[model samples]
Structure formats: structure tokens, C-alpha cells
Target: MVLCTCFFVPPLQAQESPEVDIGGALRFNYNLSSWKPEQKTRGGDFGYDLFRINANAAYKGIYLNAEYRWYSDGFGGGMLKQGWFGYHFSKNKELQVGLTQVPFGIQQYNSNNWFFNLTYYVGLEDDHDMGIKYIYTGEKTEYQLAFFKNAEELRFGNDSEISHSRYSYDVAGRNKEINQFNGKFIYKFGGNVLQRIGFSAQYGSLYNLDTEESGNHYGLALHYEASYKDWNLKAEAMNIAHNPENAASTPDDTILMAAYGAAYEVAADFNIYTLTLSRNVPVNWGPVSALQFYNDFGYMQKQEDDFEDSYMNVTGVLLTAGNIYTYIDYAAGYNHSWLGGNYIDDFSRGTPNANWEARFNINIGYYF
Candidate 1:
């Protein structure tokens, strides 16, 4: 008994157990551009310096988990950005509450990767409207079931008091967009094999503030991913069906438009890629981006193409990018819409609008 106790005690003293790691970064950015929406509205031209900031916190636990992002851009209103609380059953599965981006369409990708979030990418509105989600991550398959408030009709304010939303709803029929209960589901199978298939759907009508439009709709996204050697083929067929009976006129309709794109890992540090053609859509701010006012703009070649020209060569909006302490969070790179022909949007139409001129951004994160 004494020999056994001594051996076990010595091993225990030499080894350390596992606990959770908790710390987050303060994403900072300083912009010198003309297109930063806030600057545009503030009477500052292309050269006035603008600064933005964001903060995050995480608790990686087995039973509980949460993440929030706060950023500011000087405009577009504050974002309730991402506020969700979940109870984990398995390490990769859980039940969630609060504003959650429904796991739909290329569920593996983040909200930023998609072309348009306004589409039924998730159960609609980037927030929670009496919603719930269930995620099951199996060894060979991953599944998601989400139910949240859908924009049934167009309403103004956040008058969700009747809908059990903790936030106040404004009467937004004429001035805002709202919807009814939106629901979605996605199932992904196959590992890092040669290919994988996934299916997703979103159903609801738009209603905010209060006027429920005459058109009610549902959206379907069929996604697939496969590789032939180093070449990866990723595609999606997204379709939306609208019921004309719900509307007064012909109910401006859209349908069967989807994703077709591919990526080829040319080497370890680079990849050749292309995506389907799509139009541009605008999105407002959230609680997080609002508070941080931060943006991230990567390296740019001074636009001074001519050998003799040198008067602020780069003139366009810049996406002041943020960085983590040890790794470049370039994956979660924030986006900004710059004016001039160098627009990030699919369509470069009317980008150099008004007096908006060329803009650029620089990051001096730690103001020491």
C-alpha cells in the first residue's frame, strides 16, 4: 500500500491538469481615408485621420461558452453584433440562445465570407428573435437546426416586447424592415475526404417596425465541396421562392441565383481562387462594430504608378485590418467599402459619388 501510494503521489505532483484559457485582444486601427462612412458624414475629406477600436472576450469551456465582438466605424449605428450564450453537451455540440448567426449554407464559413447576409443566409435578421439552435458535430457528420424570429412583414422599431425580445421594438412599418419566425437546418457529411455535400434552408417574410409586406418567401441553399488533387471546387445553388398572393403588385421576385466558386492551393503560402459573379448589398452596423469603430486595411502598393507622380497616390477606401498578438487574424479580416473604381463591391457603379475621394488606412494598434 505504501509503495503504491508513493508512486501515484509522485506522478500527480509532476503532472498538471487542464483548465480553460481566457483572454482576448483589443483590435485597433487608424484610418487615413475619404470613404470611412463616419468621415464622409463628418465633413472630413480624404485625408483626415480616423481611429477605430474593438474588444473581445472568450471562455472556452465544456459546459458553457460565449464570444462577443465590438468594433466602431464612426457611423452606421452600433451593432448588437454577436451576443449568444450556449450550454455545451458535447465538446462540439450545444444549445444556444441570444442573437446567433444561424448555421446555414457553407456552415463551416463565418458570416463575413458570404456575399450577402441579407439573403436567407441564416434565419434572417442578424439577431435573435425568439430563437433557438441545436448543433451536433459527429465524427463524420455535422448538423445544425435553428429557429428564430423571421421578418414576416416590414416594421420599423424593435417592438419585440410582444415577441419576447428583451430589446425594445420601434414601430418600423414604413421606416424599417422586420420579419416573422425564420427557421433553418444544415447537415454536412464527409471528412477532409475528396468531397462533401450539405443542404440548408431559410423560410420567412420581411416585416420590421410593422407593415408585413404582401410577399412571403422561403430560400434554399444547396452546397458542395470537393477536391481534385490540390484544386478545390466549392459551389452552391441558392433559390428563393416568393408567393405573389401575399402582395399587391407582381411582388418583385428573384430566384434560382447561386454560388459557383473554386480554390486551388498553388502552394503552402498561396492559393488561386475565383468565385461566382454577384451584386453588391449594403449592411448597417451592430453593437460590437459600433463600440470599437475599428477597421483593418492590409498592405497596399502605393498607387503612385507614374515615376513623377507622388501626391497621395492611393486614393480609395481602406479596410483597416486588426491583428491578434501572436497570429494574424487576417482570416477574420474586417471589410470596408472604398470609393473610386477600386470598390470592393461586385459593381463599381457610382462609387466615386459626391466628394468622396481616395482613402487609405494605417494601424498603430498599441499607442505607446
Candidate 2:
């Protein structure tokens, strides 16, 4: 999520801006889930509900990041997490020196809803670590490398709804990286396609700061992507399950998969995208996860002539569960510079817990 407002004026191209400005996303959340809370006496509580507020800052190139949210302290015995910070380096090289997330884990895929679809189509893995990153930029080339100290991986299906980073995969996976390193490269061709390759490796214990044998670990990742006009495709393969600890008492434990996605402009004001994923639960293909995949389909529609602002979108999961639930969103509002900052847009209802849940969020989205 991000924020950028400039009223009483028209859209300013990059060449129009002189100084490096700052911006961010200020989000407020209100939801009601069907899960009941536990009471001390009855060893049970009632349904869980919460009101939350989150703010994220974005500085042109200096920094762009968000928070973990702690607006509501009481949410079914859950833990709170603060956001992270990243420092921009010379050119594009950067050193994220805060509680940033792990950059590995997911491949840079092509999807119209990648930016807004939180659960239905996108996967954001958060790891608590004081890390650093180096990004290389060229005319048609790009690369990135990241590392972490106290690394942790969130559970797949268990990290949603309220997205609480509570139990770590280190339970069955005490696997932490005392030090983790990753690298990726992207090159453009004459046609309208991009080629990408990513590699990640790490070593350490359950506690990144510890030296326990039971928590030692290491792994690697590989990915590829191509894009043309309003269409794109991506695939990722990995072997995180591989170990000298296979079920056959052999060094043969691994999980691998390949994913594909495509998008097309259905109309001038609407774009449609669909993704298909397959995860290899049977065997490991070399250093790749055989079939760890899911299918995500979405539609993005918007209209902006010279009047108001509006958006309607829907993302659905056609693959496995624990991967993504579903989402529906509609937003519309207008901005004017002559007056103080003020805006409101809410074209949705029946959200949160309804069978056909609809998420309609009204945002004042004020900024100076």
C-alpha cells in the first residue's frame, strides 16, 4: 500500500518534480470473524472482532515500507508486530537496517492485482531480522541480494485474517538463518519479455542468534518470468523440503512446483488476470519443488475522466486452500486542491464474515 496526493493541479510527470518527496499509506481496519474467543473460567471466549489503524511511509527513493499493526491490543491472544525500515543507497543499492521481511521465498510474478490482492493472489512472507540489501540497476537489467540475522518463516494458511506472526515455522522448522543471502537478476530483450533468475541460501539455528545443531539449516530458490503488453507469465521452483533426512532414510526430502499466470485488458476501464499454480507434493525435481502451486484469478476495473475516482476488483483462488481465501473491494472518491484535504469512497458492502463477504472501505485519504 502507498499514498500520493496532489490536488488543485494535474498529474505531474517525474520530470516535473524537483526534490525527493515523501508519502505513505494510512489504513484503518474493522473486521468480524466467526472464530470464538476463549474465556478463563469457561476456557472459552466469544467471536473475535477488532478495529485497527496502520500507517506506512514512502520516500520517493529514500525508503518505502509499511507496519505490522498494533492498533487493537486485544485480538484473541495474538501478538503485535511493528513495521520495518529500509535505507536507500547510492543509485539503487540499498541497506534495509530494521525489522524488515525476508526477500526470498516468493518469485516476482506478473499479475494485475499483485499490488492490491493481499491473500487471494499474493504471498508476502514476513521475517524478523536486521538485514541488508544490494540492488543493481542498469538500462535493461536489475539485481537484488538480501540477508537476515534472526530469520523466521510464517505458516502458509495460518498467517492470515489478522496476519499474526505468532508461531514460527521453526516449531517443526526450528530452521533459522544466523545469516541468509539471496540474489536475483532481470534482463530485458528487444521483444516485450523479461528473463529472471533468483538464488537464495542460508545457514543457522532456530534462533538466528543461537548455535544449536537441532536448528541448523540451508536452502536455495529458482524462478523465471516473461511479459508482453498487458499479458505476463511467471514460474518458481525450489527445494525447501530437501534434507539428508528423507522418509526413505536417504537424503531425499524436497518440495518443488511451477506457477503460471496471464492477464489481458478486457476493456478500456477493466483488466482481467488469472494465475495457475501447481506444487509437487510427490517428489523433488533436482533443486526444485515439484508442484507447489495455486491458481489465482482477478479483475481490476477503474474509471478516471476528469471528475471523481473509483475502483472495483475481485480476486478468487481456484487452487488449494490455506493458500488464499477470496476478496472483493470497491472504492470511489474525488480530490480537489482548492479546499483542505478531504475524500470519501465506499461502493461495497456485505463484507467481513458474510457468506458472500463484501469489503467496502471508505477512506478520507487526506494528505498535505
Candidate 3:
């Protein structure tokens, strides 16, 4: 998951004296994988993960939010996560321009685990792009409409080589994502037990430089979230399809997706279902104040016959202590990109009857 700082300003305080806040996080990760026998033999690997800087500023009715991150060389070295300028039209309406998060599926996250759900792998969750967005907030409803010109471009012009060293995954290489439109609506039910139901839809074009033609892609999702005291639940179902006009020699069953300095093949059409359940337990154990235990599960059903499906399940706990946060997770997957199968073959033309692989991980971060 793409982790970043978030700022919330009350709607009633739209116009404020010039204010600026800068903060960031430092994180480290350790993991042992079943797929890597060498690593298992040596126990595990622990190393620096990332350092990020976030800035937020507001003057009058205008605001700016930006984040930049630096990761280990193996991951994307350095890149902008998100930067946007927004204007408050009124107490409940705003418009944002520049690189912004795509309003889809769950709002901030669909899963509480550090690995996130499978939707994130396919760019259905926590994806960001260059776009203009309009947001409206009501007492019991919310709406977001956006139009993205294309995915984040490292260099101008279509002839330039696509860079995989970015934060959010998108169609890369010969096929480029362009002219995307998104609309999301949500209704909230307030009571002792809070609940929210939402719908999201997106349509975009895939411009193939080799074929010099544009194919289309679309997605629809239905999501629900509920909270009752310390218990929380989230569920979502989505269908995504990509029809790319590629060179005749290329296969149509898969598309190229790139992120974090790497590109991989993903199934062209699939349906994804995800569910997350969690409970918060409060405690006073020295500096540790609370812990949240969660289980996140996701399944991807491929549309093509004979193609293998993908499965991911994560059981984790989040520990909160002042400025420090930590996650301990046991994650397992079958036909998953980061789990077992070959590096680039897990999501596309996956191994049938693939055995499940597992990983144990710990991530700790300090936020200012």
C-alpha cells in the first residue's frame, strides 16, 4: 500500500490564516518468505524501507498537499506520491487539480494490513493519476467526479519511454492509459452502529503506440463499510476489463502493468472480491496504547476459461504507540505477483494448481 500523511480541515473553517505544516515518516521492514528457501535458512532480512516527506499549506480558500518519498534501491528510488492544489468552493464542495488519488472502492484503504488487498495490485485501490476532481460532501451523502488525462508521465510526448519507477501502477509500455473518467457516490447511515455504502465506476482508453489504435477499459465496484464500537468490517466486489489494441503478435489475454521500477503481465479481465474484518483492543502497556487485529482476504476470478485464479489472505495486527506504529502479519497467497509463482508470471498465464506460499512480516514506522 502507498502510505502517506493525510490532513483534515473542518468544512466550516474553509478560509483560514496562512498555515503550513510539514511532516513525514521513517519506516523499516523485515520479512521471511516461504518461497525463498535461502532467506528462510538465514532467518529473515531486515532493512530500511522508506522515508517520506509531506507538506500541507492553506491560505484563504486554497490549499496544497504534496508528498515525496525515497525508498531502497530495489524499490523505486525516489518519486512523488501525490501533489495537488485544491480550492474550496463552499463549506461542502471543493475542486482539486494535479496528481490526485482516484476515488474508487474504499476511501482511504480497503484493508488494515500492511500488504493491502489484491485490488491494490491491479490498480483498483489507492491508485493516483494526473486529474481534475470535484468533491461534494453532504450530511448523509458524498460524491466525487474526476477526469484524468492520463497516468503520470515522467517525460513529455508519447514517444518517450514509459518509466516504471513510480508510486501507483498503471498501464505501461506499448499501451498507455488515457482519458479516464471516474464517478463515486456514497451514502452514510448514522446511528449507534455506523454504516456506509458506496458505488464507483471508471472508464478509460488504452492507447497502443504500436498499433496506433485505442481500446477501452472500464470498472464497476460496490463497497460497504460498517463500524460498531471496536469492531469494523469492509467488503467490496468489483469487475474490471481491459480491451487493448496491441500489435498483432501480442496476446490479448494479458496486459502490461508497471510500478515501483518493475513491469509485469496481468490478466486482462477479472472479477475481484474482498472482505476485511478487524477489532480494536485498547490497553495501557507502557508506551503501547492500543492494538487492532484484522484479517483481509481477496479473490480474483479470471474471465478466460482455463486460466487460474488468484487468492490472497493476510492476518495482521496493528500496534499504535504515540508517534510509532507497527504491523505484524502472516500473509499467504496463491498465483500472486509478490508471493510464490515466477516473478512476472504469477498474474498472467498463472500456474494451474499452484501451491500456496506464505510470508511473515513486520513493519515499523515513526511519523512526526
Candidate 4:
């Protein structure tokens, strides 16, 4: 979400203050979800969520950008989400360095749901990497090329869960990218109705702590998006493959062991598909301003034959008024995570005779 709070220096204080752009946002959420069998887990299904601060400035031809985030679960511990500095040679070209988002997938994604899609958790989309990047923007096309040194390896606490890296959420658990290369190209066409087609690719050598071996991770994706009237539609399909070195040598107690138990294989290749549709409606009521309705569906299938597919359906609504925003969503997953089994088509919810696992979630936030 883009939020900005502007400040103007008073005439009396203008001489003592420097002109700079700054803004930040505060977010609080009370979540109600069926996924929580016990309500007390993770702050009792509702609590303060996030606080973020952003600043951007440019002097001469050099520019700097930064963002810091604090999570409620961390007791308000600060995390440098993004910090980068670059030289703006021209309006359409620039080179950036530091910790930033890897430009391999769509920005803002294609979902209105706060949780995003499954690929996000898998580290294929909305993942950031510390790297150096060069970008080129033309009238009808934009291109990005980057070489990332690592795949987000910053840690804080000693606890494994709390100290885990953000960008290494793949199933294999070996997500420490020793080295990586990423590139994406987007081309736009059509006149009245804007249309865009894009391609993205990434390659990384992920380090495994158990065997101390590095695995190869690679993926390719094709996506399309169109905007018309109040409707925004998006679709993407991708193939992600992982090749772990010395898989048989891994001990039976690590994450690799669990991954082996789930897939019954050393290496895995999977195909994932995502589709999203959203519409905006103007509204006039008390504090209510505008409304957005959206639906996001995602499906994943193993490349191997006879492997079942997993899917999730998310439907949500967004309400925006001034700097305040609220989102309410209903999500259902079938044969998808551990809570709902690992495969598909069984219509079983991992339990003996259950159907599917469903949850309702809501988030409220305000920008300052």
C-alpha cells in the first residue's frame, strides 16, 4: 500500500529545518480465523500488527530510499525492510544497490487479500534479495536485471522461528541463497484498455545447513494483466524446480527430512497457477469511502505423474477512507498445507471425514 503524510516547514522554522520528504504508517489488526484451534496462539487471534516508516530524498543526481518495519510479535523490534541508494542518470534509467525487492514477479501482486497467494509463502513472489540492480524504462516496456548476493539472510533472536529469514520460505527449507541472478521484462500494449505481458526468471544456489551442501533453484513464469473500467484482472503460471545436492546424506531430523517425507523424493519440480479479479465501487457512507471486491485463486501441482494438486480460494473486500483501510476475507484451502493434508482431489481435510479448512480474517490499518 502507498501511504504518504506530507509536512511543510513553517516560515519561522524554515531556516533551521532541512527540506526532505518523509512519511509513515501505523497498522493494527484483530484477526478471527478458523485456522486457530486454540484462540490464544499468536496473540489470541488479534493484536497490534505492524508499524512502518518510509523516507525518500534526492539531491543533485543521487537518491536514497529507506523503510523500517516493526512487528507486534517481535515486541516492536525494528527491522530494516528496505534501504537503498542510487544515482538517477535519467528519468527512465537508474542503478540501485543494497537490500531491495527482487524484480522477478509482479509488484503489488494480483491479490487484495492481506495474506497474498501461496507462492508468496513459497518465496517465488513478493520476495526480496540484497543485490545490485539496473532498470530501464521505455515508453512501452520496462526491463530489470539484477545479481543478488544472498536471499534475505538477516536474523535477530536465537529462536529458530523468530530468527528465520523472510525470503527462504520454500518447502525444501534450504533457502539461503549463496548467489542468484534475476531478470524480468514487461511490455505494454493496447490503447483504451491497457494490457501488459511479462516474463520473469530466477536462478539461485541455496545452502543447506544439514548437509552443508548447496542446492540449485530455478524458475520461469509468464503473466498477463489487463485493466478496464473498474475491473482489474491478472493471471500467472510458473514452473519452479529444486535440485538438492547430497539429499540421501541428509539426517532424518532436519527440515530436509520432513520434505522427503512429504514428497518421497530427493528433488521436486512443481507448476503453480494464480488468477485474480478485482472491482472497485464508489461509496458514500459515514466514515466509509470506497469499496473493492476481489477474488484470488491459486493451484499447485507436482511435475511428477500421479501427484495430487493443492489449491486455495480467497475472496475479500477492501474499504478505504482517507488514510484508513480495512480488509475482510474468507479463505478456503483444499488438500493444501499440513492442516488440510498435502495433496488434492480427496476433498478431505486431513481428518477422518472432514471436508476443507476455512478461515475468516480481517485487518484494520491507518496511515500517519
Candidate 5:
């Protein structure tokens, strides 16, 4: 027994220590919007936008990743963007637990602009929740399955009211999202030009606090992506339905969604389609290494009668220089939230005669 114990102790002592890395970013923004007439008269506005910290650590097969961010007061003051612990069973299989990104149409992002797309406004893109995820990567295919308990909760207990200070939009106000299941599958075609086709599905229960009853929501999407040389293209289409068991006084055709310290009503049933194209060009300009020019467009068609549709288009260029990155974008929208129209009515009832509004924005960031 003593000889066997001695042999096991040496192997344990030889194990490597954990590797840790910490980094952060500081960013500032300048923008001029046609919607804000007063700001347009003042030659637009420039201000601090975000400060963030990222930490990652790995020990053998276990790892952790987290990010915390501080935004301007108009946005959420401070929030946890993501935090998760993961275990790698092998090089191609892993599991993540905690506040992780929801497995949806696209993996990281569906758009390549500062302002994402109409899909993001409708809570379909880049949405994260409190969940556990399992990922499998094969030679020509990938799979992801997840179960989210809820969105990130700001406080403890059974409080019915959810806070609006968050990074991801979720069902708020009288309804909360619960018991969500997500599944995504992707097939890759390898050649000179890499191509991928994927499908995603989601189903969740909407627990109404006011009525003490549960409703349901579901979404389905199909997406395709391709890259050839310096050119890339992405396209996706999806349909979503939200049925909330609200109080008798509330409308059934709309639901409340909250993020960035604000709440707004969104159409309950809608179909969204998006397309993006980009080209990377190598440059020899001073301190600027490369430039990527992209255009992203999204359209939303509401299902209710007399409801106006929403659409957005963003044309942007990203400049990368060592640790400094800059994005210059010209974005235009019609009856879209974050672009123009009334706060709570834009995505719900909308204005039939709404004119196109445009904004010019520049964002600079230093990452380390």
C-alpha cells in the first residue's frame, strides 16, 4: 500500500498549474442621427461608450470565462455580459454551464455592424440566458443543445418584477421566460470556398405574474453562410410567436421586452429575414493594417392586421490597427426601434407613413 501511494503522489505533483489571462477594453462613440433634430443641430454628440473587463482561466480540462461591462448612464450602468464554467471532454466536445450565449441562428453574431439588425431588436440574435449547453464538433457537422432556466435575474427571491438593466433583451414586465430549450445543427461543405448551412429551433414557457398562468413561445430559423477569398455572405430567415397569458386588460398582440435600462412593446408574431455581405481588403495605410466593408439588412413583417413593417440597413467599415479598432457606419431604418419613431409604439403599432431615418456613427476602441 505504501509503494502504490508513492507512485500516485508523484503523478499528481507533476500536474501543471492553471493558466489565467485578463484583458479589458475602453471605447468611445460619436454619432449624428436624423431622428434627434436637436443633436443634429449641435453637430452631433461624442461621449464615452463602454468599459469592459474579461477574465479567462484554464486548468487541465476545466475552464472559466467571464466579462463585466460598464456602459454610459443612458444605457445600463453596469452588467455582467457573460460568465460560464466549461469542461472539455475532448478537443471537439464540451459543456458550458451558467450565463452563456443561447444557441440560435448564428453562433457569435448574425451581423457585422455596430448596430446589429432587426433580429436583435426582436430578441432573436446574440441573446444570452442562464443556461447549460452541450456542444459537439465533428469533421463536417456541428451540434448544440441547451436548456435555459431563465434570463439573467438581477435579484433573488420570487419577485415578479424583473429589472431592465441587462445586456440581453428578454421578456419582462408581467411575463418572464422560463424553461427554454434550444437545438441547433450545422453542416459544413469544405472546398476552396467554405460554406455552411444550419437550422435552429427554440421553445419556451412564458410565466405571467399577473395572471398566474403560463403561455408559450417558439421560434424556427434557417441560415446559410459562405466565404470565398476576401468576400463573405450570410443570410437567415426566421419566424417567431409569443403568446403570453397577460391580464385581461393587456393586449394579446404585443409583449413587453426590456434591456439597457428600458422597456418597450414588441409585436407578438413576426417573420424576420436578414442578409449581410462583406469584403476584406488589405491596406498599407499608416498604422492601419486592414479594412472590412460590410452591409447588413434586415426586414420584419408583422402578422397583425394594419401593423406596419420594420426594416434596417447598415453600411459600415471596420479598421483594424494592432490593438485599436474603429467602426464607421451609416445606418438607415424605417419604423425601427433605436433608429426612429416613438419609444413604445414603434415596434408594436408603428406608423404607416414613417419616413426613413439615418444615422452616422463612429466607434473607436482599444483592447488589451
Candidate 6:
């Protein structure tokens, strides 16, 4: 046996890999007319809509993500959209704890329209809260569960100026609503034409600080999406049941009825349905590398027996090239606030009380 003389080799130090990425977005908006019926002639507004910064850091299996934004008009100050830290067991699973988005409805929404759908106005979509959440993304399924405290509307003070636009609706006042739980699941199937179906639910308990009473709110949603060729279609329907004590005395209840002609009293419920269709145009010329046409429709039915139904329709075209994007939309509404019409339960303003209006909106964004 040949003896092999070997020198001792020092073990290499295990290096810790770290990564960080920073990004930001700048947006601008120009309006041809205002949405409020009382301010029909107001238009020619041009200014910065939003400026935001996003950052992410990762080391080992731990990560941190944050987003801070500045809005020009309504908010009038910087705000934190999301800030979260989590441990990632794998690429498909994570447990996060911090201020993050409430995973109750379609993630990021399906419409390219700037205002989104009616669900957003009711605090069911694109809303964030302080929460602890777990997410699991499998090959054909995705699941999310979270428990939140101090939702977006309740977390902020009531000093901000209120506008009739979509960005100014705050349903949760200074109420002590806590222990809100949100859950969602989505399953994907189909081959060439990809398809997905999802279900989401949220529940919370509210304690009226003013009246010393307690109540609850529950919501459920079903959504579906499909992609065929260059066209994408999405449909969502949701029901929200509100059972707040002394609902007639709540500011949100009063605003809800006054703004949208919907009452959220004891056992008050409402249903919303939204449908969107988008297609990519086969044009990749000049500075515009991509073009898409989209249309969105939303309908809301209130629980009151004599209440008239509300609807909104938006049509727009979007263009994208590199990190620059822009969209132009024409929106119309019946019995909707942001869309133009102002519906009141009493109809005291008469039959022709500016029940409908149309506006042109353009938004441009740059990402870096």
C-alpha cells in the first residue's frame, strides 16, 4: 500500500451573501374635468400624482421590503404604503410580519384603469394594514392567511382634506377595530389558455369609541381570470355584510349613504361585480414598444329594497416603452361618485340633478 502524504487544508470561510435593490416611481396626472357633480366645470388640473420609492434587502433566508410614497393633493404628505420583514423557507413560501397589503381580493387588481374598481372604494381591494401573514405558492395553487390590526383608514388621523375622488374615501374612522383576519386561495389550471380561480374572505370586529358599542363586518369574494392569445379577461364578485352598532350614528355610515347611496346599518349588505377585458395591440414601433386597450365595467347593488343600482364604465388605452408608461381613459358612471353621477337615497335634487357626467383622464409614470 502506497502511503499518500497529505497536508492539512484549512476550511474555507462560509461567506454570507447579501443583496439589495432600490427602485422608484414617478407619476403625473392631467384631468379634463372633475368627477363630482357639484364641481362639473372644474378641470385643467395638471401636477404630480405620486412619487414613491421601493427597496428590498435579503440576507440568507430573511428579507425586508418597504415602500414610501408622496402624493400631491389629497394626502399632502409622505406615507408608507408597505413595510414588511419575513423569513423565506423557500422560493414559494414565506411568513411576514409588518405593515403589508391585506390579501383579501385579487392581488394588485386586474384592471389597468387608474381608479381600479368599485371594490377599492369600499376598502376591499388594494388596501393595506398592519398584519402578520403566511403565504404559500405551489405549482398550481396559492394560499394566503393573515391577521391585521389598525387598518389603513383607522391608522391615520382625520385631518386630511376630503375629496370626492377615489383616493379620499376613508370608511374606517377612529373606531377601535381589531383582530381582522384575511384569507385567500387561488388555484390555476388549463394549459395553453391559462386560467385561475380564487376565493377570499375577511372578518373584523369594531368597537365604536364614541358610542361604546361593538359590532362586526364580514366580506367574501370570488374571482376568476383567463388568458387566451393576447387577450386577458377577469371577473370578480364580492359581498360585504356590515353589522355595526348604532350604524346611523357612524361617520362612515353617513358618508357611505351620502356618497354612494348605500346604507351600512345593522344587517346592511351590498354586492359588487366587476369585469375587465384587455388586449395587447400588435404594435411595437418608435418609442412605444407596447400598446394595450382595456375596458372595465362595475355594478353595485345595495341592500335597500328601493335603492337604485349603480354602475361604472371605463375605457382606456395604455402604452408602455422601457420604464415609461402612460394611459388615457374616458370614464362614465350612473349613480357613482367618482364616475360623475351623484345618487342620493331621497332624490330631493329632482330627476335631472346632474345624475351623469363624463371626464377624460391621463396618467403617465416613469419607473427607475
Give one digit per residue, the lDDT tens place, for model 3 in 1-368: 00111124344455557989999999999999999999999999999999999999998768999999998778889999999999765677778899999999997888999998999888887899998888888989998989999988888875665788888889887888999999999999969899999999999999998888999999999999999999999999999999999899998889989888899989999999999999999999999999999999999999988788899999999999999999999999999989877769688778988999999999999999
Error in Å for residue 287 of model 1: 33
Clash counts per candidate, in order, are 70, 32, 0, 0, 0, 0
What tens-digit string does per-residue lDDT give for candidate 1 at 238-297? 553443232333222211111111111000011111122211223343311111211112
**Residue range with the least summed lDDT across 10 consecutive positions in model 2:** 257-266
What range of 10 consecutive residues in model 3 has the weakest lDDT sum?
1-10
Error of 3 at 210 (Å): 0.6
Q: Provide the TM-score for each candidate, comma-separated.
A: 0.45, 0.43, 0.95, 0.79, 0.95, 0.82
Please report, as a residue range, the 10-residue window in candidate 1 with the lowest summed lDDT.
262-271
lDDT of 4 by residue, 5-92 (tens): 1112111111233335788888777654455656635544666777888888765545678887776443425566678887644566
- Give the distance in Å from residue 288's predicted Cα in candidate 3 to where it truly belongs: 0.1
Using lDDT as the yardstick, the better of models 1 and 3 is: 3
**Candidate scoring better on lDDT of 1 and 4:** 4
Question: Per-residue lDDT for 3 in model 6?
Answer: 10
Which of candidates 4 and 6 reaches a greater TM-score? 6
Candidate lDDT scores, in order, read: 0.34, 0.33, 0.90, 0.66, 0.89, 0.68
lDDT ranking from best to worst?
3, 5, 6, 4, 1, 2
- The top-ranked prediction according to lDDT is 3
Error of 2 at 366 (Å): 12
Q: After TM-score superposition, what is the CA distance of residue 286 in candidate 4 from its true location, in Å?
A: 3.0
Number of clashes found in candidate 5: 0
Question: Ten-residue segment with the worst summed lDDT in candidate 4?
Answer: 1-10
**Per-residue lDDT over 1-368 for candidate 5, one digit per residue giving the tens place of the 0 to 100 score:** 32123223222122269889999999999999998989999999999999999999988657899999999778989999899998765567677899999999976899999898788887888898998888878989998988999999887557567788898889889899999999999999969899999999999999998889999999999999999999999999998999999899999899999889899989999999999999999998999999999999999989998899989999999999999999999999998878877778688889989999999999999999
Expressed as tens digits, the lDDT of each residue in 26-104 for candidate 2 is 3233222122123223443223222233445544434445433322334323332334555444444455655555555
